[model samples]
Target: MALKNVIGIDHAVVMVKDLDKAAENYKRLGFTVSPRGTHSAHMGSGNYTIMFDPDYMELLGVLQPTEHNAPARAYLEKNGEGIERIAFTAVDSAEGAEEIRARGYPPVGPTDFERPVTMPDGTVSAAKFRTFQWPTAEAPGGVRIFACQHKTRETVWIPELMKHANGAKRLKQVLMVAPAPATEAAHLAKMIDRETRNEADGAVVVPSGGDRADFVFLTKDQLGKRYPGVSLAGLPERGGAGLVIVADVVAAEKALGAAGVKSAGGVVVPPADGNGTMLAFVKG
Candidate 1:
């Protein structure tokens, strides 16, 4: 059978110099992050995950300079605390890799990897994943893209871990700024095996078929107009300039107030207050 198209982004990966500080910043923004997870010595990295059902956010950093830590360290140095990767979801990762190969964008894996995830009962279980990864070097704009198949979903998406104080329900869209929206978005769509359509005033919008999310691509000039306060510190490499999410406006307002965040007016956290990642919360 032909593999399924991109089901939507599985997760947005953020690289940080300090996982503790990163988690603390997210907490200040009213998010509930998971416990620290250590990668195998071969991988040489540690992470904190924010679970949102099947979709989650990953904050990764180097544990030490091992084989795996090199990549994370390099990304942190190059990007300086911003989005480093975007993973698309597929029912079968190997199949997803095959589809990418067919799409003219050759992929590296559907490689099997697992980390011991602590269960709600405090028992340890393997959180297995079949991942097809595309390194930033392969992408036109140096943004990492991949397909992920979750083999043990239950072990990762425990119900208790899904709740957040920010009242964030789900990720709605990702705001991206590229030099040329149409050209860059077309390339990305092909990688994801999704369709790209033009939006008003020289922008491209790619709607993920796998889930309720969209990728909005715009020029830096247009992005500035739409979100005045957002800083364009890191452009295409940062990848995720802004993240849109469904959230309770009232709760967001309270949280922003308590955090002394003046940028978020009920539902928006501009880059200034959002760890260089602009955040827009859809009032619901």
Candidate 2:
């Protein structure tokens, strides 16, 4: 009745030009990596791998060059290489997808898959996922939710791998940048039947309903200023697009430094000639 309560931050996807390279980058940052999988057979994209946490992170790369489905390619061409999609855990993938489609929005499918994941215990686990996409004019900045049903919930790798001595817990919030936060907020409110808060800086914070993942939408100016020279044309509309992973800003800054990943005033920008993947560790 109150719109399905959000579960939690499920996973964040980073679109990279090179999957192997990006995986290495995250591995150096302390994420326990998983075996690589090719989505080309199903999604028409390239190679991808999941970095585990209770919530998760995805590294997506364009493997084969083709003009058939150009959205992924266009994203890579325009943005260079950065965060591509953010997937939220939904209450019901089929029902959720149907609900959005019935709202006069573009259609999204109920897709599911089973993939192998390597746990820190050096064990292989087959994880199942069900996903849905919501179409909006905002594409990458749009609110897209993905509901994942793990074949086995007994072993969640996120809590173990992403744990920090500084008590970084789980992913609490994801900040998104968009051209029109107010309109986007209204659309999402109608789609999900939830209330959204409009901030003074023209950003919107959609609470994750207690323990679920919270989504924050910021303006282009805010994102540009934060990242300096990153482009935002290729992000998906109305789905999990642009994201800023929430953390203790000071601690995260120090961690990034230790990982040898340069930050532009505490922001990470994707390669200049690559797609724009921007992330900032802001104090919650």
Candidate 3:
């Protein structure tokens, strides 16, 4: 069964060794990051968020060495900081997991988790979710995938957190590098129940969430064409590579310059401050 354009991005996760420093770097890049928070003991992870309208970017790091944080910590130690995974916004995680399983993709869990959220005005609430994770171990040369179902939307997103110094509005695309782009694309297409198209440049484009965002797979060379400034020195063979964010690149550059954050092409945030993930700014 052909799936509709149902998979939309909830947020992109950047796995860093230190969450505080990572959030500071993103703020220097002109994003307005949220207050740092940790998950319940069972989930044992911490995060700082850059919330955009309907979408966000999470700077995730491990906390205590409980069952939840251990695996995340292990991945961070091995990957050495970079885009960890892209969480797709789903209406229902259980239903979504069923779709993933039917399509032959291994579904890790349709697990429920919640985090405490303190509003900009000091109000507290529980931001809850149900997630279906597709582990990275399964897709060695590909990026991690998961579906997120939000339970308390109001607690997570509010007007105060949406404004950023860079005028960034939305996540446009996620770039993944693979040795065999076509083969990986075919498998990924099935996982999301979406049609994956083979591109002229040996890439595949998969539209997610009403086509609001795109999951694009390409070789390192092809990705370089899209982001000329980013160096592929220590990039993972099959992993999350670059994040394409929609913003006023020129204005964003000004803000970044004032903060002394130098971007390669006035649009690409270099690896150092980007926490191993290439940040690409594009005009919306």
Candidate 4:
């Protein structure tokens, strides 16, 4: 069974060297980027969120070296920039931590943090969150995973921020490239107390709860086959590759064309164009 209080995907954490630049690039790609928000001083990081209805994407960058942001810094130095972590929706972080501990994976923290969010109406409020993670070395397929409890959802998920010009509605899949796709998928499924489904093309899928995004594990060769002619140069060998978005493909193609960003076959945005992570848009 899935851990108590742990629901579906909440958001993806895309580590970037420059937060503002990443935000700008995503805006040019037709996303409605949220205003930059700085985290607690000790964390030494800030982020810009691309909001969807129940899930979102976060572009995170370190402002300075700090004990808490060491991993993020290391990742940025090593992998440059791309999807580094994914957060699951936690109904109650404290309880979720306990459940994770019981499942044999020691939890990291039920820590609290807050960031100031500027509302559409010029009002600013603190968006609080409680989060916990599995062990650092326990990342499945080299992608760190965590659980997040949104203490103030309204402040973060402002209505205006969810409307994107590309008609990007929600996450469909999070792609991870691994040497052994089945093994990695099974590892993640066990970690989340979920089941894995095999695909005909030899990929493996771990479905998150409800209509949330599924984690898709594929071999590097499979990834290449999936998006022919797209460059995967900066992508880590055994880590996150990209995101598949449920969107209006026609609208997305038009938006990219208008911005002068060419997509492979009018569907797949290459990593070079996506700030080190690939993006694929498909009809829901």
Number of the top TM-score candidate? 4
Off by over 4 Å in 3: 2-6, 135-137, 258-266
What are the per-model C-alpha RMSD values against the true structure? 2.6, 4.8, 2.5, 1.6
Better of 2 and 3 by TM-score: 3
TM-score: model 2 vs. ground truth? 0.72
Model 1: per-residue Cα lDDT over 1-284, one tens digit each: 22475577788777777889888888888888887888776777788888875578888888778864565577667767766667778777777777778766677776777788888788888788788776446653445777778888887787888888778877777777777778878877766667788877777888766555788888778877765554555554325677777877677767766443333343577665666577777664
Which has the greatest lDDT?
4
Residue-level lDDT tens digits of model 3 in 188-217: 777666788777877898777574678888
lDDT of each: 0.72, 0.55, 0.77, 0.89
* Tens digits of lDDT, candidate 4, 1-284: 87769888999998998889899999999999999999999999999999987899999999988999998888877888888999999999999999989989999999999999999889889999999998888889888999999999999888999999888989989999999999999999989999999998899999977778999999989988877766777788888999988888888988877433334444777777787788898877
- State which candidate, 2 or 4, has the greater lDDT: 4
Model 2: how far residue 43 lies from native, Å: 2.8
Model 4 score (lDDT): 0.89
Determine the C-alpha RMSD for candidate 2 after optimal superposition of all C-alphas: 4.8
**Tens-place lDDT digits, model 2, residues 97-196:** 6666666655455677665556667887665666666662435353344445454555445445455422233465566666676776666556555688
Clashes of 4: 0
